[model samples]
Target: MAKELSVEDAEKKARELLDRRIASVRTLVTARQRLAELREQVADADREDVRLYNAALNDGWSPDELRKLGLSEPEKKARTRRRAAAKKTAADAPGVDHQEPAPVPAPEPS
Candidate 1:
């Protein structure tokens, strides 16, 4: 059997429980804030990774080489397709000249 609490003792216990609940809520909020910060850091790191990968690609580094260096491959963007489509549309439109310059003939061998 459990001992019965006096009115004062019961009220004190209730206040203690409420205080613990408030502390738990505060800790949860702090944890959430830290999680948000971590997510932002991860996003920033990913951007840097992509930027470096693209730079390496532009510098003639092979995908295999990058992989050997333990770097992740950057995702290909649809921008190239979009740009090609735009160019085609503009060239097909009236008043647009998309002709390539004529190549100069090589000099005859001596």
Candidate 2:
């Protein structure tokens, strides 16, 4: 079997490696934040573009004319939403009776 690192040793080694990777790690974090900001701006821009196109169409601008003017139609991004699962109640569950049935009595000897 391969040698395993102890908890303390692992943490120590991890800390040591972090010194080499700290700059790259910081860069990754900054890139992620920048990407998020850009995505928000893109969404806002898409909404604005669609609004402008519709308003222009209402103002008698043709589709051909809009296309010739270098405007591209927005491709919408699909967002997935998660819903919370409903909790089951004891009464709603099967084979879970709240009240007990009456007991049966034995017959006497003749």
Candidate 3:
């Protein structure tokens, strides 16, 4: 014979499950934030490595030596046509202020 649960007991069981689910969601949010922080730290480390490599090169380090140290110049990024078009459109949009100053015209040669 199966026992029938009272309404109060059923409500308590439901509340417990809801509490567990809320806790799991909170844990998930915390884990996601930690992952984002870790990614940023990795990006910062990459930038530091590039800066150090540039400094070493400027100090007369040979490319071969740099390669031996597992260092290389950062690759130039090539923009796709779609991205270029979007960028140009954005730049040409009204009320958009570009950070770069307008080009100064060179003085006429004497």
How well does model 1 score by local distance difference test? 0.86
Residue 90 lDDT (model 1): 62
lDDT of 1 by residue, 58-102 (tens): 999999998899875966546544344444566697887779889
Top-TM-score structure, candidate number = 3
lDDT of 3 at 98: 68
**Where is model 3 poorest over a 10-residue stretch in terms of lDDT?**
79-88
True-structure RMSD, every candidate: 23.6, 8.8, 16.8
Greater TM-score among 2 and 3 belongs to 3
Q: Native-vs-model 3 lDDT?
A: 0.86
Alpha-carbon lDDT of model 2: 0.86
| Model 2 TM-score relative to the real fold | 0.48
Tens digits of per-residue lDDT for model 3, 11-72: 99999999999999999999999999999998788778778878998999987898888876
- The lDDT values for all models are 0.86, 0.86, 0.86
Rank by lDDT, highest first: 1, 2, 3
- Candidate 3: list runs displaced more than 4 Å: 1-5, 72-110
